[model samples]
Target: MMGGNLTGTVRLTRLALRRDRIQLPLWILGTTVLSSTSYTAVREQFPTEADRVTALRTAVDAPAILMLRNAPTGTSDGDMMAFQILAFLAVLAGFMSTLAVVRHTRQNEETGRSELIGSMVVGRHASLTAAMIVTAGANLVLAALLALALIGNGLPAAGSVAFGLGVGAAGLTFAAIAAVAAQVSQGARAANGIAAAAIGAAYLVRGLGDAFGEVQPDGYTMTSAWPSWLSPIGWTTLVQPFAGNRWAVLVLPAVFFAALLGTAFALADRRDIGMGMLAARPGPARAAAGLLSPLGLAWRLQRGTLFGWAVAIGLFGVTIGSLAGTVEDAFAGNEGAARTIRELGGGGALSDAFFTAMLAMVGAMAAGYVVQAMLRLRSEEAGGRVEPVLATATGRLRWLGGHLVVAAFGAVALLLLAGVSAGLVAGLGNGDLGDRLVDLGAAALVQAAPALIMIGYVVLLFGLAPRLTVALAWLGYAVSLVFGQLGELLNLPQAVRDVSPFSHVPALPSADVTATPLVLLGVVAVALGAAGLILFRRRDLAL
Candidate 1:
C-alpha cells in the first residue's frame, strides 16, 4: 500500500523537470553568476591583507551594515566575499525552491492538472513526492554549480563546498516550509505568499541577530545573537564558510526539513483533493460597490500585495537614508572606496551622491513591484477567472486597461512612499528637511517612468505569447537588473547598459536634472503599452 502511494513518483518527477528545464537553469546560473561576479569585484578592490582588514573593519563598525549583511568571521578574501554575497544568494535560492514546489504541487491541483493525472494508477503521494524531488534536485544542482564557480575563482575547495551546501540547505528548508504551506492554503497564490513570507521573516530574524551580536576582541570577528538560532538563514551563515567551516551547522536545517516534511505529509493525508486544511471563508452574496467594475475588481485583487510592498519598501528606504550620514565617516580615509561610492551615487557632495545612488537602487526595487503587478493579468487569465469576467458586460480592452492602470499607479505610489520615508529620515539629521524631501521625492518619483516601461514589455509578452509570459517577463527584469546594477562591476559595454530603462534615468541630487531621457523613456513606454493593448484585443483569450 505504501509503495502504491508513490508509484508514479519517478514519472512525475520527470514531468516536473521537463516543465522547469529553462527556468531551473536560469535560476541556477543566474545565482552562480551573481556570486562569481561579486567575488571578482571584491578581489580587485582589496588586493592586500591590510585593505581587506580595513574593509572588514568598516563593515564591523557600522551597525546598519551589520543589520543588512552578515558579520564577518575574518578578513580573508573568501570570508569577505561570502559575508557580502552569501545572504543574497541564500534568499534567491529560497525563493526559487518555494516557487518550484508550489508550482508543481498546489499549482497543478489548482489548475485541475492533478485531477487528470489522478485518474491513472498513480499513488496519492506521487505529486507531492515529485515536487519535493524536483525542488531538491534543483537546490543540489545550484549548490554544486555555485561551489564550482567559487573553486574556479581560486578559493579553497572545502570552504567553497561548505558555502554551497549552506545555501542549498537554506533553500531545501524553505522548500519544506512551502510543502506545508501548500497543504494549508486553498490557492497557489496564498501558498506562495506564505512561503515567501517565511523567507522574509527568516532574513529579518537573521539580520536582527547579527545586528545585536557580540563582537569578538579581535575587532574583525563577531558572533550572532540568540535570534540567529531560530532562522534557517542564520543557520546558513553560522556554517561560517571560510572562517570556521562548521559542517555541523548544516544539521539544523536538515532537522528542520525532516520535521516540516513529516508535518506536510500528515496534513496532505487529512486534506481532500482540491481543498486545503484551512477552508476559504464564504464571500457576501452581493458584490460590493468596489467590485462592480473592472477597475474596482483589479484594485480589490491587488490592494493587499501593494500594501505589503509599500511597507517593506518604505522601511528599506528609511534604513538606507539613515545611512547617508555614515558614508563619509565610514570611508573617510579610503579614497578607493569613496571613489566607487561617488561613481555609483553620481556627482555633487558625497552625501548627496549617496542619496542619489540609493534612490536609483530604490528605483530598481520599484520596477520589481511593477513586474509583479502586471503579472496579475496572466494569473487571472490562467486561473479561468477572466472568462467569467468577460462573460459579464466588460470588454477585453477595459479589463486589460483596468489592471494596467492599477500596476502603473501602484508603481508610482510605492516609489513616492519610499522617497518620502527616506527623505524624511535623511533630512531630519541634516537640518535640510524641506529641501531633501523635495529632491529625493522627485528623484524616486522619476523612477516611475522606467518602471512603466517594464509594465509595457510584460504586457507585450502576455499579448503575443501568453504561455511564455511569466518566464520571459521575469527574465527581462533579471537582465535589466544585471545591466543596471552590475554593468560597472562587469565592465559591460555602454550599448548593453542602454538596454536597461534604469540606465537612462538621470542620477538626481548629485547630477543636474535632465528632462530629455525622461521624456523619451515616457514616449517609448506609451508606444509599447499602446501596441500591447491593441495586440491583446486582437488575440484570442488563452485557454
Candidate 2:
C-alpha cells in the first residue's frame, strides 16, 4: 500500500457510483428483463409437453434460431428455454463487466485521476481493488436478479441458480480479463478494445462449441475441437442448466478470474502508474500527406475500426451462409412452421423466408458497422485529436462527411456480402441456384439506410455534448438491441419499439418490403450530418 494521504478514495468511489448508477441499472435490468421475458413467453406459448417437442423439433431444424439461441440438441423444452435465454444473458454480463472494469480503472488512469490519488495515502493497488470490488458486487446483484427472475418465471430453483451462476461467472471472468487489459494499455479506449476483442473471441469459441455439439454412437457425446473448452463462455454454456444442472462448471470462470487477476495485480506492482509494461512507439516527426487534412485525420483515426468491421461483418455473413441448409432441415415436416417461413420469404417459398431473416440479422450487424463510424466524431473530439484538424483549412462538414463515407460504404460492403452468401446458401438448399445471389443481395442493400440512422444519432450527440456523446450513443444502441430481438417476448412499451430504427424495416420474406422507412432514414441521416457539422464549426474546443 502507498499509505500516503488516504482521503480521496471514498469520495472517488461515490463519484464513480453516482456517474454509473443509471448506466449500471440499464445494463443489468435490460439483461434481466430480456432473459426473463423471453423465458416466460416461450414457456407460456409452449406449455404442453407436446408444445415443447414440436417447438424443439422446429427450432432444432431451423438454423437461424439454433445459431442465435444456441438451443441444446435433444433436451427438454424447458432446457431449451434456458439455453436460448442464458446465452444472450452471458454475453450481456460479459460485455457490461468489461465496460465497468475499464470505466473505473483504465479510464481513471488515462484521464490522470489516478496520478492525483497516487500522491494520496491510498494503497498502491487501491483503484484496482475498488474496481474489482464494485464490479464483483454488481455481478452478485446480477446473479441474484437472474436467479430470482428465472425462478419467478416458474423455472426450477436448482436450474435457475445454475443459470445465474453461469452468468455471474462470465461477468467475473471478463472483469479479470479487463483488469489485465487495463494494466497494459495507456488509454481507456485501447484497453476497452482489447478486452472487447477477448469477449468477442469468447463468443465465437462458445458459438463454435454449441454449433458442433452433435451426439454420436454408443451413448458418448462428441466433443467440439478444444477451442470451445478454452473459452469461458463456452464453459458457461456447457453447464447444461436444466437437464444436468451441472453446477460444478461454474468453477472454471472462477479459476480463470483468480489466475488472470493475480497476474494483473503482479503486473501492476511492476509498472508505474499511466505506463504499461509495453511502451508505445513514437509517431512520425511530421504528418503524412493524408494525415494533414481534417478528413485525412478522421480517416487515420477510423481506419483500424473500419477494417475490423469489414472482417467481422463479412465473417458474420459467412456464418449465416453456412447455417442456411441446417435451418431448412429444422422446419421440415412441420407444415405450419414451414408455411410461415415461406410466406415470410415472400410468395417465393419457405426457403425464402429463412433467407430474409438471415439477411436481416446481418443487416442489423451492418448497422453496428455504421454506428462505429458515426461514433468516431466523439472519439476524435474527446481525445483532443480533432482539435488541430479543426484549426486548419478543413471545413467541419468535410471532416464529418469523410467518416460518413466509411459508414455508408462499409455498411454496403458488409450487406453485399450478406446478400450474396444468403442467396448462395438458400439456392444450394432448395436447388433454386440461379436468382439467389441477386435477389438476396438486393434485399440486404435495402437494410443499410435504417442502420445508418444510428450513425446520425451518434454524430448529433457529438455536435451537442462531445463528452457524453459516446455514452449516449452506446446507451441508445443498447436499448435498441434489447428491444429488437426481445421486443415481442418482453411486451415492451410501444414507444420503446418505435425508438429503434430496425422497427421500420419490413419483415421481408413474409411481409411486403417497402421503400418508406429506407427513404425516411436516409433523409434523417443527411439532416443530422448537416446539423452536426454546423454546430461543430461554431463551438470552441474544450482544450
Candidate 3:
C-alpha cells in the first residue's frame, strides 16, 4: 500500500527539479559565495595567533556578539571562520528549506496544481513525497558545495565536512517543520507565515541560551542550557565544527527531522485534498465600515504583517542597543579589533561606527518588509484577485496606489519605531534620552532611502515584467543586502559597492550627512516609480 502511494514520485521529483533550476541554483550559489568570502576575509583580517586570540577574547566577553555568533572554539583561522559564519549559515539554510518545501507543497495545493496531478495515476502521497525528495536533494547539494568551498579555502577537511553536515541537518529539520506547517495551515501564505514564525522562535531560543550560557576559563568552550537543545539552529553550532567537532550533537537534528517528518505524513493522511488539517473559520458576512475604499482594504490586508514587522524590528533594535556598551568595553584595548571596526565602519568614532552598522542592518531588514508589501500587487494579480476589484468602480491606478502608499509609509513607520526603540534603550543606559533618541532616529531615517529604492525596483518589475517581478525583486534585495553589509570586508570593487542604494547613504553618526547623494537617490526612486505607474496604467493585466 505504501509503495503504491508513492507512484510517479521520481517523475514528479524530476519535474520539480526542472521548475526550480534557477531558484535552487541561486540559493546555493549565493550562500556558498557569502560563506567563502566571509571565511577569506576573516583569514586576511587576523593573520597571526595573537590577533586570533585577541578576537576570541573580545567575542567571549561580548554577549551581543555571542548572540550573533558562536563563541570561538580555537585560535585556528578555520575555527574563527566557522564561529563567525555558523549562525548565519544555519539561518540561511533553514530559510532556503522552508521556502522550498512550502513553495512545492502548500503553494501547489493552493493553486490546484496538486489536484490536477492527483487526478492522474499518481497516488495520494506522491506529490508530497516528491517535494520532500527534491528538497532533501537540494540541501545535500548545498552541503556538499559548502564543504568543498571551505576545503578549497584552506580549511581542514574534517571540520569543513562537520560544518556542512550541521548546516544541512538544520535545513532538513526546517524542511520537515515546513511540511508539517503546510498540513496545518489552510493557505500557502499562512503556511509560510507559520514556518517563518517557527524559524524566528528557534533563533530566539538559541540566541537567548547562548547569550546567557557559561563559558569555560579558556574563553572558547561554552555550555548552553536546555533552551539551546530545543532549537535546531543551536544544534548546528553545538556540533563545534573546528574546535572539538562534537559528533554526537548532530544526532539531535536527525531525531527531530525524523519525528517531524513522521508527524507531517500522518497529518497529510488525515486531511482532505486541497485542504489543511486545521480548517479556517469563516469571516463575517458583512464588510467593516473602514473597508469602503481601496486604501482601507489595503490596510486591512497588510495591517497584521506590518504590525509583526514593527514589533520584531523594534525588539531587535532594543536588543542590539543594549549590547553596545558591552561591545565597546570588550574591544577597548585591542588594536586589531579597533582597526577592523574602523575599516568596516569606513573610519570613525568606535561607538558611532557600531551604531552606524546597526542602523544599516535595520535598514536592510526594513527593505525586506517594504519589498514584501510592494509585491502584494503582483500576488493579487497572479492569483486572479485583482480582476474582480478592477471590474468594480476601482481603477488600476487606485488599486496600485493603495498598496504603494502602504509600502512607502509603512517602511517609514517601521524604521522610526526601530530607531526610537534602540535609541531609548541605549539612552537610558547612558543617562541621556533626548539627544540619543533624536540622533538614532535620524540615523534610521537616513537608511530609509535604500528601502525606498527597493520598492521602486519592485514596482518597475511589476509593471514592465510582472511574471518576473517576484524572483527579480527578491534577487535585487539579496544583492543589495550582501553588498551593503559585506562590501568593505570583502574588499569588493567600487562599482560593485555602488550597486546598492545604501552604499550611497552617508553613514550617519559616524560621518557628516551629505545632501547630494540623498537627493540623487530620491530622484532615482521617483523616476523609477513614475515609470512603473505609467507602464502599469498602459499595459493590460497579464492574468
Tell me, by lDDT, which candidate is best. Answer: 1
Best by TM-score: 3
TM of each candidate vs. truth? 0.90, 0.86, 0.91
Per-residue lDDT of candidate 3, residues 1-543 (tens digit): 999888989899998898788877888888899889888878788889887877766666555556667656777767887777787788778877887887778878876788788888997788888889988988899899999999998888989989899899999999999999999987766776777778778888887778778877876556776777888898988888877889899988888888999899889899997788889778799999877789998998788789988888988899867866675776787766665566555568877777887788788778988887887787678657889999999998899889888888999998899889988988999888898899889989988898889888888999999866766777788778667665765667789889989789888778889999999999999888889999999999874
> For residues 264-299, what per-residue lDDT tens digits would candidate 2 score against the true structure?
889988998878877888989988998766667667
Q: What is the C-alpha RMSD of each candidate to the true structure, in Å?
A: 2.9, 3.8, 2.7
Candidates 2 and 3 compared: the better one by lDDT is: 3
> For candidate 1, lDDT tens digit of each residue in 1-543?
779889999999999999999888998998898889878877887789888777666666555456557878887778988887677678888988988998889888877888899999889899999999999999999999989999998999999999999999999999999999999998787787788779888988998898788888977678989998999999989999988999999999999999999899889999988899999988889989989899999998888888988988999889877876787887687665566567777767777777787778678778877887888887788778899999989999899989999998899999989888888988897788899799889889988878999988988898888866767787788778777766765556799889989888888878887999999999898888888888899998874
Cα lDDT, all candidates: 0.85, 0.72, 0.82
Q: lDDT of candidate 1 vs native?
A: 0.85
Question: Which whole-number lDDT from 0 to 100 does residue 21 have in model 3?
Answer: 85
- Which ranking of candidates, highest TM-score first? 3, 1, 2
